[model samples]
Target chain A: MTLASALIRAHIRERLAAALALPIVALAASSIAMAGEPVTIRIDNFTFGPETVTVAPGTKVIWINGDDIPHTVVSQTKLFRSKALDTDDRYTFTFDAPGEYPYFCSLHPHMTGKVVVKAPAG
Target chain B: MHDPTDPNDDPTRPSRRGALECMVWAGTGLLWTLGGGLPRAVGLERALAAEASPAPFSFLQISDSHVGFNKPANPDALGTLREAVEKIRTLPQKPSFIIHTGDISHLSKDREFDDADQILRETGVPMFYVPGEHDLLDDEPGRAYLDRYGKGSRGAGWYSFDQNGVHFIGLVNVVDLKAGGLGNLGAEQLDWLEKDIAGLSSSKPIVVFAHIPLWTVYPEWGWGTQDGARALALLKRFGSVTVLNGHIHQIIQKVEGTIAFHTARSTAFPQPAPGSAPSPGPMKVPAGELRQHLGIASVSLVHGNEPLAVIDTPLAG
Candidate 1:
């Protein structure tokens, strides 16, 4: 084979390898995003059902208010806040940090709930 | 109008004086008879005061409502709690405040607290609370409870106040509860309690309310406070002290060194008396009879010329 042809063939092989690796990286990233577990929170009446929850960091949490009353998901540590969600309304927040986060309804001081963020599982 | 000149009147004057002295002696005897039974009469008066008093002031004692609880014992715990509040409203005398001993909710759900709050607010009386093991099931000793009902309380929801010449204290014992471990007051609260009570004179009446029984009611089920002895020691100097608790969900009274310890019933559901069941959980009775088992307590204090009397009346018969 000619030396120029050999160099061109090598360059094509390297380009082919890079192209093949790109899809795999994209696939892995998408899988991680999809693999994130969803934390479910039920809100009924004047309370947050399950009052306390334990979730892994980066988990997406969905709070559905099923009660006739309105509620606010305000974190005590100021981790996050979901503005007033009325009956049948839904709110979602992602917890990226691992710590104990206590929350309450800004409207009803007596309505309290807690979220426990745990380290990601190995 | 006396005729002093008459011989007959002069002779009768000494005799009249002697008769007056005899009447005075008779009156003294009657007064001694009444005074001899004064203590017993006062005791009887207290018993009657507990039974009947016009416009008496009382504070409600509610414990272990466990709003989110749906165990076999109580399917509708919140319903029963509402019934208890209804009973409180119909009470002849409205309570001045409501003191929740603990376990206000079963799962410590925000909804449970909401349900409990809804029922409690119906009473039209201010409410005071302490934490229970069920309330502090979260990692942060149930910060939600503190944020809502624990205003003006010290760390972990302990505080003291004075009402009608009585020193009222609210203590927190469930902060570091272990699995199947008895409630604990920890050292810091004990220190605070000592300092809090140090300034009060022994003559002042003291009422200490907490979630766990300061006295060992049932050690097997972890119904007692682990460090309650230290707390009691600080209160020993008071002439009349009352220690109130609620975790056991029943009435258990003990008197030690002039301090009376009483546990109130849960407005939500009933638990079997310590060791009566396999574990401490809701106890279901017939629907009609559930109200009889679950009731609120009204504690009244009468402060007049008599000693302070605390009367605890159950909602049910």
Candidate 2:
């Protein structure tokens, strides 16, 4: 093969590799989006299950009351609050910022939990 | 009126051991009567005789009527409450009025409150109430309770009423509870309490009732109030002070100087004593033994220097 032909082959190979990398990057982006899928914290027996939850930023968190009694979800700093949740009732909140948010049930204050939102990986 | 037995004479300083010992004795069939600031445990026969006798004016106290609770502890809460009211109706001497300490409803739902109201009204006795945490679980947080029972009450439904020369103060301490803390009366309610009894003479008999125990019974289960001490301090100057409460679902009485503290049992169900269970909730007894744990309280005020006589009558024991 001549130098011209070899140069063309190299360019084609480089272009092919770049094209293959595009789908891999796209798959990674889709997975990152999936990372924000909703998380659940169950309220049962006057307790918050899993007590503490860690999720990525922008992830949505849901609290479902499983006890026969009513409960409430109120943030420590008054950032978010849910009305009294009867049995099987649900409340949803999204953590958009990377920080620690602690909350408790206003009705039964002993039931407490925390949410830790992690920064996205570089 | 100060109890010479209590050296400190501080109403706020209660002995937890004394409270616990009293609880154990409560399970027996004996009834308690407070005379001259001392709780005297009498036989069931003598207590019945005392109840048959007359006094200046007697009132009934029914607490924790969780009308909507359908748990295994007691499947028919409303039915049991009706039974309690039935007992009230059949009393030899009808109560002048009824003082319901709190937890009138289970979930604070409209139907729960309605059911409780319907059953309690059957006795045809005027009722006074303080809100429990369960009664304030509505979406608006205590709006349902206040709307129905807050007529003349101030700031979360705390109010005072003069009944037969006794100054009755109904306090609200279940609102604005702090996280990981017990019940709270808040600064606003505390200020209101101070002024509510400011003009009353020290000799005037004061009866303070609230849902949660104003003194620390057990903090692990959130049975006590965080700012309850502040309110008790305000009442320390008064000679004849009787603090009645419910939420523990059992009888635990204490006497410190001129003040006497007592917690009434629930009309619906019973709860494990302080730390007996993993947590605090409806505790189920064996079959045919549930009534033994549920009951009502009757208090009699004799016109004189004699302290009020509080009688706790279980549904069955």
Candidate 3:
């Protein structure tokens, strides 16, 4: 083949590969956005399910009261405290910085859970 | 859960209403006791002949006003509580004092406390209060409640006083609780309670008032006290010991010889019956029926054979 034709062919191939890679990169970006999405934790049967949860900083965490009685979400270090959450009620807190958070139901002291907030994963 | 009716249940881990149901099936009422050194369920015969000797003095118990609670179950907790206060004032016989079981506010806010205090002052009788879980939900632990009602109370707001020949013990059980659990009387308070009644004679009439039920009403709803059994043991020998509480927001009476456990209905709103709902939260009864379930507990101290007689009067009829 002529050198010019070969160069053009290679150029076309490189452009095609870049075009295909664009969607792949976009897909990965969306998955990362999904990773930063809010997570929900269930509080039921006098327990905070998934008692230990790890999430990226800035991710919002929601706690839903599934139990019959009223409950409160109080952080160990005074980080946050929710009002009495009745049945099906919810309390949301967004972790803005990385730290370990241990919390419990103020009403039912036996029901406890922890949250681990970490820097956004690369 | 600390159900006295079920010996099989674990003292630390209380079960469902199964034990309470058992009390019904056994032909014995859902009554648990703190009479003698042990706990047992008693019957109607166990009821002291309260009328045998006419009552000399009386006290009122009102609780859970939740002044800021604007939820559907009670749009105007303040209004209902006002109704309760009116009922207290119009009692057939004036009570010597009033004991508020607790939950005086919904969010422990200054305004809520203010509203509760403003209205409660109308009773024109001295009122004793022990904080509820709701009352302690402020920025500082019990700072608001203590500021308003903790005067002359001991550590964390617990105290004992004598009135009309009856030893009244106001215990603070909601200071430190288990995670999503019931009320707790820590070691310090327990110690104080032990010494408070150490010198009293067996014939002395005693009255214990707290925010949560001393007996296990329902574990699932955090209605009982974790260390209540221990606290109650000290009063077992007294001939006329009455335990009054209010957290369950319902009327439940039990007689165990001289020690009678009675939980009063809330002045604010009604919660679901034990195990009647999916969970224990507020219940929105038909608008007109609210008064039937929400009211005050009037306990009469008749200088007679019976130590105390508790008559629960609803807000309406």
Candidate 4:
């Protein structure tokens, strides 16, 4: 092959390789998206804003108490306990297991909320 | 009026006068001891304490029990809550009613609610409740809480009633909470509160109860109500206003004008003070003092010509 043709052939091969890598990169990005970032729940007054949260396993659930009073981010199934958060306090716990974690304010037994952890789809 | 020369007055001139003076002195001493000094002896500091004993009308304020919680601090919160009820049952004076400031169930689950109900019902005291953020975890705000305890309340379990010359208001502030926001008493509730207290005379005492603190105890952990000022303003006209809350799980008291805000301790577990820990969570104490740190608040009402004295006694056991 002539030098010019050989160079073109090499360039095409490189382009093909790059094209093949795009799918792999896209797949990785999508998986990361599915895994989701940490979910932040702001606890104030007597209820959790964004009462129902959807996240994936390995996602960290951060509960921030912004009320002037203290509160708790307690899981229904005994999954985790953020003892009692005072004003501007925060508690973060990762959900490695996939399931619905319901919680309530320990101070006010009537106050309740939940977090749902989804598993990674195959 | 008898002559001094008579046997009654002449022989011992000081006899009758001295005897009468002595009798008068003894009478005065008896009055001071039995009538005036008895109240003081019993440690009655305020003038109103002399009126009458608080006719045994008491109510329970159980806060931050954090049911549905499992941790080293309190492995079985529901179990401990049952213990608290047992303690209440053994009280010399059983409270006529119970008020849960918030956090009735940890997870807002049917089972959690069921467990809390089973445990709480053991007390046999009529219970009233306000929602905590955890109680509003469902898709709808306070759906489970309202389903169980929000009867006769307005939207989201905010309501009011009259008992023993006091106006009691239960407010819901956890709904529509802002980002990085403290507790919120939305406009609707604010209007309602204003109207609720509008008709009451200034002499009438008002008790406003909620799950979040109406005053700023700590802002970082959302300890104060976002629009509590508005609520206080409505209560300004009242002679005595007591704002009771439970989300803090600790005892913090503040008085503003006619208003007094008190945050009660959690029966479930104790948390560190604001900024004490990196974040707010259960603080494990020695097993012995756990119950002491966490207990119920007893508010006794004695209706008389004076302001109601709310004496808060933490659970000793």
- TM-scores of chain B alone in all candidate structures, in the order given: 0.79, 0.88, 0.82, 0.80
- For each candidate, what TM-score against the reference? 0.60, 0.83, 0.75, 0.63
The TM-score of candidate 1's chain A against the true chain A comes to 0.67
Poorly placed runs, candidate 2 (over 4 Å): A1-34, A120-122, B1-28, B33-40, B50-52, B303-309
Listed for each candidate, the true contacts retained, as a fraction, are 0.00, 0.59, 0.51, 0.00
lDDT of model 4 at position A77 = 64
Q: Rate the local accuracy (lDDT) of all candidates.
A: 0.68, 0.82, 0.75, 0.69
lDDT of 4 by residue, A1-122 (tens): 99999999999999999999999998887777576777898875556878888787788778897754456676666667675575678999987777788777644444677788887656
Q: 2 or 4, which is superior by DockQ? A: 2
Cα lDDT tens digits, model 3, B1-317, are 34476553445542221112111111122223333334454453443332344345666778878788876777888999998888778765677788888999877889999999999999999888888888887767789888889899888899999875567899988877766567899999999999889998665667799988888888776778899999888888875577888888888777766566778788778888888976566788998888887887666543212122334567775
Ranked by TM-score, the better of candidates 1 and 2 is: 2
Instruction: Write model 1 residue lDDT over B140-250, tens digit each, in one string.
Output: 547888888778888899999876556789999876444334678899999999999888766577779998788888776567777998898888876567788887776
Write down the worst ten-residue block by lDDT for model 4 chain B: B22-31
Interface RMSD over true interface Cα atoms for each candidate = 12.9, 1.6, 3.9, 10.4
Model 3 chain B worst lDDT window (10 residues): B18-27
Better of 1 and 2 by DockQ: 2
Which DockQ values do the candidates obtain, in the order shown?
0.02, 0.45, 0.31, 0.06
Q: Write the per-residue lDDT of candidate 3 for residues A23-54, one digit (tens) a residue.
A: 99988876654456888999876678889998
**In model 1, what lDDT does residue B303 have?**
27
TM-score, cand. 1 vs. native: 0.60
Candidate 1, Cα interface RMSD: 12.9
